[model samples]
Target: MSIWISWMVAAGVVVILELFTGTFYLLMIAIGLVAGGLVALMGSGHELPYIVAGIVGVAATLALHRSKYGWKKNSDASQDPNVNMDIGQSITVKEWQDNGNGKFSARAMYRGALWDVELVAPAAAAGVFTIVEVQGSRLMVRA
Candidate 1:
């Protein structure tokens, strides 16, 4: 088989694999292979060596991935309401409990189940407490 036909077949296979991986890296390599095939077709004596094409494909893929989806150290805080929805929900304290480690108690009717609660202030009375923050399933409260 001709070099051009072989390169084209290889490029087509890489592109098909790219569809499964979805990482864009494989697609880049496929593009490089297509370019090599084109060079072979054009009879450009300056054919891209397979190793050089592979390296170029990888570098291009990485650069594109970084520029398009890289993490930013200074990204703006998320504005989604789901993250801040628990700020002011009223919760009922289930027991009269206290400790020297600030204030703590168990609460019922919170986010579905009884929860161990802690607060920055003492809630001596067992009743409803406002949820100020949530740490996992535990609620931080204030009376």
Candidate 2:
């Protein structure tokens, strides 16, 4: 019925939505709605509450934008498989095979599975290759 009650309800709804979104934007706006409610409680005009709410919301959102948690994560981290724990493990190349891509490949037993190993350069007979990077189940290595 009262303006303060309406602002409080809006803030409560935003807070509920923030739980599912996992973002700080909604929570910042909720802070603004709470500010509006407080202004309304102080017997201010209808316009003043709205203005206060807008200003508070903008300020809060900007604060969040500048914070570390607000920005998007680096996509490179997800694309590079070398970030994994088993990246630097070594594998033995019993023999080298032609990959048809102008690079040589081989089958190596790694992590309990026969993995496709990509050798950047020619490997020696019965050479051991240290895993430099992983691409899916395959490994990129140097002799």
Candidate 3:
């Protein structure tokens, strides 16, 4: 088989693998392989196609890595509503207990279980509170 045919076959295999992986990096390399195939079809010297493929693949991967999709915004799982389903849920704090560290806390019944609750600030003894953060089994609340 011709060198161009080999290049095209490699590109097709990479594209097939990219489908299962569901990431664009493999697709970029496949594009570079296609470039190599095109160069081979133009009757370039044997080494030039390999060099062009390597350069194009690396450049495409680097460009993708520098794009916005490459990075995700770091978020605290306890406070981010998307991470925790109970972050914005309201609960009733019938009383606040002084932990003696100048902080007030209470145990509140939530989601059919009693959860340890900590107040964000010193508030009145009894009122409805919104869950702001969840640290383990403890729910941090703000009035």
Candidate 4:
């Protein structure tokens, strides 16, 4: 087929990939493909169309990366119950001992993993404790 047809075909493939990926990043490449296709149809030299396409793709993609559209930060991911189910879940401590740091600490089994737990302020004597928050592999607890 013609050079322009090739470019259009590539653009269509990228657009289809963007749908599956749920990210608009491939759309930026599609923009460049369309640009190159236009130049190819205009009878530009072989190298010129590719150069224009690369420049347009890179520039447009960078512009998109800098924008706060698809590149947004979700502040709720930290607090979302579905995202972090262990936040409100309970943890059981065999014993709460003050190894240091004033607050009581213990090694407890949570989700089949041994976690270093720190009881908030006045620590519980022992037994079942509710998980207040989790930072890394450590658990912050409240009795």
Candidate 5:
């Protein structure tokens, strides 16, 4: 078998594996394998192809690691609207059951279900509130 063909096969295998993992790291390595295949196709020395592949793979991985998509934001998922669709959505709090100790909470209907909601701060009761965060089944809201 031709050396270039072997490199292409390896790259194909890596790409297939990448589909299952859903991360781009394997895709970068596959790109490196494709680079090796290109070097071999140019009739470079066997050792030269290996070196090119290694360098390309490492560089691509590092580049990906530096990209925004590669790293997750530090924001809490409960407060992020992107993670919890309920965030930023408004709900009605007909009344507040004062828990005393300077805390106010109530059960409100949301998304066709009853939800435990608490004010972000101890404030006067209001008919409307905006969801700020979700903790398990409980929702934190603000006026």
Candidate 6:
């Protein structure tokens, strides 16, 4: 069989496999195979150099995927119009710290709940301010 025909067949099979596995990674490989097939059809050479093509395809896929959806900060706390919005927001401590790790229990109304919180850091005293860093069914506080 000619190099072009082989490449074409390989590309078709890659595409079919990509369909079976919905991962974008396989689809990227298929794209690379298609590129190699096209190169073969152009009579670049009989040996498609699949390794190089695969690398290029994978790289292209990752680059495109990363660009399309990357890290994003959660600004919903500020933008969300809800009652419990103040749960993760910063708050003032009404009580004092009694330990080295700022371990103290204090009462603060947040997200419409009267929470029993112990500060994670002891250095943060009763008068100083802190943030509502975590909230479960209960709340965890930090300085």
Q: What are the lDDT scores of the predictions, listed in order?
A: 0.70, 0.84, 0.91, 0.86, 0.93, 0.64
Residue-wise C-alpha lDDT for candidate 4, range 11-111, written one tens digit per residue: 99999999999887799999999999999999999998899899999988999999986577766543456687887788889988777757788999988
In model 3, the worst 10-residue window by lDDT is 64-73
Show model 5 residue runs off by greater than 4 Å: 73-75, 97-102, 112-114, 121-125
| Top lDDT prediction, candidate number | 5
Per-model TM-score, in order, reads 0.51, 0.65, 0.74, 0.53, 0.81, 0.50
User: Which scores better on TM-score, 2 or 6?
Assistant: 2
Across residues 1-143, which tens digit of lDDT does each residue of candidate 6 receive?
Answer: 87767777887887789788766666677778777777777777555556657777978777757873433346544233353554556666677546554356777765576766667654555554445544444445566
Candidate 1 per-residue C-alpha lDDT over 1-143 given as tens digits, one digit per residue, 9 for 90 to 100 = 87878888998998888788866777788877877777777665644646556766777777777785533355322322356676677877757566656556665676677776776576577777877777777777789
- Winner on lDDT between 2 and 5 is 5
Model 2 error, position 113 (Å): 1.1
lDDT over C-alpha atoms for residue 56 of model 6:
72
Clashing pairs in 5: none
Evaluated with TM-score, which candidate comes out highest? 5
Tens digits of per-residue lDDT for model 3 on 1-143? 99999999999999999999988899889989999999999999999999999989889888887888655679899899998999999999898889887798889899999999999977857889999999999999988
For residues 13-48, what per-residue lDDT tens digits would candidate 5 score against the true structure?
Answer: 999999999999999999999999999999999899
Q: Name the lDDT of candidate 6.
A: 0.64
lDDT of 1 at 36: 76
Q: What is the lDDT of residue 84 in candidate 1?
A: 63
> In candidate 2, what are the lDDT values of residues 34-113, reduced to their tens digit?
99999999999999989999999999999999898678676553235556765667788898877676678888888788
Error of 6 at 46 (Å): 4.6
